[model samples]
Target: MGSDFYQQSILPFAGIIIKICRAYTHSQEDFEDYYQEVCLQIWRSRDNFNAESKWSTWIYKVALNVCLTHLKQRKKGEQQFVSDALPDEVHDDAKAFGSDELNLLYNAIKHLSEIDRAVILLYLEEKSYAEIGEIIGANTNSIGVRITRIKERLNKFIQAQE
Candidate 1:
């Protein structure tokens, strides 16, 4: 909850939170909301962490769970809102990466099922199958199989965009 704790502990993993939030939200407002909620949850749940996993892995689990729950809540309400502008953070991310291909890949990723998006994002982050499995509560072998299928779907999606 303290700024020092955030600065030293949570801020280091902000990129992971940003990526998960972006995957779950379509607009900047929603993105900010999701991002804030994730951070808040991390702070609130800080004591719940038992150190059974690395801090980064615990962060991943928290971020993914927060986003997935937020997505489900939004779906239940089902209000449609469109925004013409991208989030500043997203634009900055694209610029930071220096590639439109990353944007294309993100667009394709948005089309995936929520769980698949998490899997691919973790895989893209170069997380080991065991780490991803530990985060998502799935078997490592299934994570591998799911990643293969998710990659195929993402490929189809990107190809269709061409």
Candidate 2:
């Protein structure tokens, strides 16, 4: 992809990566490392971008892989991050949605199996079922059914908070 396309199409998803970081990291520092790693992974994979899947779908996979790699290395006693940094676009809306109600949502998302969480997040983001299936490497016919169950489970978790 051209630099202009990356600046436009890929850059807009920075917030999504930040949101994913917020869900996965416990501190500002770790989040920064995870976010940067995700971007780097996406950059490395750009040459291989296949039009078969939506850009967002491909990004979600790369972001998750970056987090999982960092988390694994962290478990091995690596110093995964050295700083807490915030990009200019990260703002109050992300922090606002991260409130108690959405913290519950984030926590609920965490409870899902890795691939399940990927599927559900894309679903919530309103990606087509076909796109989600392509992203998760699952059957399109089954994604809708899995998403329905995911919503039901999330509803249960949210209600139990009451």
Instruction: Assess every candidate by TM-score.
Output: 0.87, 0.80
Clashing pairs in 2: none
lDDT of 1 by residue, 39-107 (tens): 789999999999989999999999999889878878899534432444344456534534788778888
lDDT of 2: 0.75
Provide the lowest-lDDT 10-residue window in model 2. Answer: 84-93
**Candidate 1's TM-score:** 0.87
Best by TM-score: 1
Candidate 1 yields a Cα-based lDDT of 0.83
Q: Tell me the spans in candidate 2 whose CA falls farther than 4 Å from its real position.
A: 1-6, 75-84
Provide the lDDT at 2 for model 2. 60
Q: Cα deviation of 6 in candidate 2 (Å)? A: 6.2
State the C-alpha lDDT per candidate: 0.83, 0.75
Name the lDDT value of residue 111 in candidate 1. 93
